[model samples]
Target: MVLISWYLMLPPPVFPPVKDASGDYKMNTTAPISQWIKFKTFKSEDSCKARLKKMPAFYKCIASYDTALKPAATPSTSTVSGAAGSHMQ
Candidate 1:
């Protein structure tokens, strides 16, 4: 039936939480396996490991930056002079 074929194409309703070789769940297991993006596909896990060994190790980290800062308050020189004159009087 068409329904059966469609169901087969759909991603599994439940996915057992799994982790990739890197031990990061978000990379390949957090989402539907079909929806997960692959950086590179290899014929086998051994080939992938071999290729990874040849490549330099790099860490991927997330960072956030905020550019908003409060402006500095400045006192005018005239105000100081006026206050000094008042005190002298």
Candidate 2:
């Protein structure tokens, strides 16, 4: 059986609350969301294969966000699909 797993990190909130000089709460417009990243691990060769074969359309869905934070020069589609197809089969 093939072993497949991946960890995906999500972008943080766009705005974080801050305390102003007046002791009132306010949104920090300049606050950056890039610092706080949350991620979870997924491990399931059988489950992934089952889902892929049951619905080939899932490839398209996976490809949709594959290049989300990748560099401009990165090749997104082929790498993700190729890896999944090669492993699942």
Candidate 3:
């Protein structure tokens, strides 16, 4: 009786949601971005970029996780560009 009552009172196990190397979690099917932005662990610049590369649209909604929380620099507007432009190649 006592053991049964104690078992019933115990709380369920709580597990931190699984996250990728960049600390981003799997996108929710029904509410993807809305749910993704709620995670607090992804408050780093690099982490945000990794997330962007994986799910760029997620960037449109959530605040930047950069050190300054500012938007990343805009990409070059050139219609034609490649790694060869700078040095590589």
lDDT of each: 0.38, 0.42, 0.38
| Candidate 1, residue 54: how far the Cα is off, in Å | 8.7
lDDT of 2 by residue, 1-89 (tens): 65546333333433465666897555332333333232434454444445555432312112213443343465789898998899997
Candidate 1 TM-score over all chains jointly: 0.23
Model 3: lDDT to the true structure? 0.38
Cα lDDT for residue 1, candidate 3: 25
Total residue pair clashes for candidate 1: 0
Using alpha carbons, what is the TM-score of model 2? Answer: 0.24
Q: Which ten residues in a row have the lowest lDDT in candidate 2?
A: 56-65
After superposition on all C-alphas, the RMSD of every candidate to the true structure, in Å, is 21.1, 17.3, 19.9
Best candidate according to TM-score: 2
Report lDDT (Cα) of residue 56, candidate 1: 36
Give the TM-score of each candidate. Answer: 0.23, 0.24, 0.21
What digit string (tens of lDDT, one per residue) describes model 1 on residues 1-89? 22110111112222466665787442222333343223454544455565556543431111112111122456989999999999998
Per-residue lDDT for 12-77 in model 3, tens only? 122455666897564443332323333333444455456556543433324433232333466775
